[model samples]
Target: MVKQEKVKVKPLPATIIPPTSWVKYFKEWHGLKFPVITCRPLGRLGNLMGEYATMYSLKRHYNVSVVMNSEFKSRIKHIFLNTSLPDIPASAGPFQLQDWTPVQNIGSLYNYAPIELAAAGLLGPKKFIMKEYAFEMQMFHQFREELKKEFTFAPNYTNKVNEFLSNIMKNRSSQLPDPVFVGFHIRRTDYKKFVKNKFGGHLPGTSYFTRALTHYRTKYPDAAVFVVASDDLQYARAELQQYQDVYFSQGFSAGQDMALLSSCNHSIITLGSFGFWTAYLAGGEVVYADVTTKHDYRFSRKSFEKFGLDYFIPLSVD
Candidate 1:
């Protein structure tokens, strides 16, 4: 006799609880079955990374099986070597199938689960949909090494990144010894308004980059090259072209750009999740505009705390 895969079907409504209702996300689970979780990805690459990492942490820490929907894989899997998590199809829109409970996350939302809850069961129903916008960076550091291995750039991306890095290093003058690369992620576009409204952040100007670059130069001297990647490349070049030893990496997918940046010595990030992940992967001293959100918001603090105690962005510099 063949075994049957049990699946439950229902239409779960979009979940958006006001601050008054956060208590429910942490509420007790009374379901008889152990929960099986799968996160539905939302937003672009940066947001997708955060969502996957959150679920990835749960899968590792809680010792439960976590799955990914096919859309998540189509958007995320190819960039990394090990998107090894199992996947299911979610082609039918807004329809929840079999034991799956919907999890709605506002920006940077995290559904907290304790070890006690993990014991014998994983907090809730037969299945969970860790719906998007889940930026749980706090515990992400705990699984950092495994995450790095899992998110390692695919072979093609690695090769392109290697060539880019090699060319940048080889073409530099002998006058600049002991070459060091400083990856600069200058975030533009919608951020000017988005940061202001959401986190009370201001978009940095050229002086911000100059100040950050100066910090690197003082430490690495002429050996430092500011390799910039930005949405507005033309504007970036216009703003900082006067600076010596500056290079701009253009015409690469975000994955390839990230691979190149991560291979570098250090990072300078303005603001935005893209910048955050690039710096996270680079794993070195980080310099940011002092304009980065000072007092973190309710759920977004994890994004800030992952940088740890070491950063070189003083108010006076900005």
Candidate 2:
């Protein structure tokens, strides 16, 4: 792991609001010349990607320096190759949380990207702050290919997953020289409630996996190899024991697990930030569980416009 101690930003005093949206009279204090936008990310890997990607997207738009919060700087820096940024000290942050601008998180709302507002806000050079949850938005699209370059997993992780895949392939009687590896992410645990309340009561179960596996089988026909990774390994093993060409990835850390799944030709997600990213990095036909109810905003087609065709498929959870 790389040491995350260095910082390039020198914190400065907050400058008065400039130009429009109601401007206050203020002289230009030349002390704050280059504006620094801080990327304040919360939650786990999924949320961090959104936060950082938003900031990265902002840097592309605003053409300024981007910084990361010290807390998450170390946790996520190792996952990707290009997450090089200065860490912000607490002193640089605003006295009150509300002091920071409220930027709308319409990354999911693909049809309209606020051209005027970067992930932080569109304004002249002055230190600005940002806040959480953005892994699945269209606003992050422009830098996505670049984001992929930035997010490419460490070589150690890739090697580990590759070795595991090789071993699994060797055991199979049929040798597909160019097998289509299909990754499956079974997200259980907290999702039972999160989905019930936020999206709908429906959740992916054994049937959901079987259906997804069946669909992939019909599509790839001869060369579909299923590689299942999950928070609940025992559940996945038990449920999928009857199927052939299916293998479980074990003895790896969470980061390694993500590396294994994202290396596949496609993905099957059961709804969560982790699953969302795995499918995204894999960049193929992504089949996600429809956790949203009929009118739920989370399941809108317009929201997922950035994705390719046949990305979502609703299956019987029971």
The most accurate candidate by lDDT is 1
Instruction: Provide TM-scores for the models.
Output: 0.77, 0.75
Best by TM-score: 1
lDDT tens string, model 1, 1-318? 111222333322112222332222233223322455677778877888888887787666555556776667788778987876766434323435454666554333344433214322534434577654766665465677787787888899889877887887788876669788888888888878877887776787966666777778888867888888887788888988887688888746788777777777789887777877787788787775555555464223233433332333332224
- Regions of candidate 2 where Cα sits further than 4 Å from its true position: 1-34, 84-125, 174-177, 294-302, 306-318
Per-residue lDDT of candidate 2, residues 155-237 (tens digit): 88888987998987787666455578998998877777776776555667876677788878888876888888888888888
- Supply candidate 2's per-residue lDDT for 255: 84
* TM-score, model 1 to reference: 0.77
Q: Please give the CA lDDT of all the candidate structures.
A: 0.65, 0.64
User: Worst 10-residue stretch by lDDT in candidate 1?
Assistant: 1-10
Residue pairs whose backbone atoms clash in candidate 1: 7-98, 8-98, 9-98
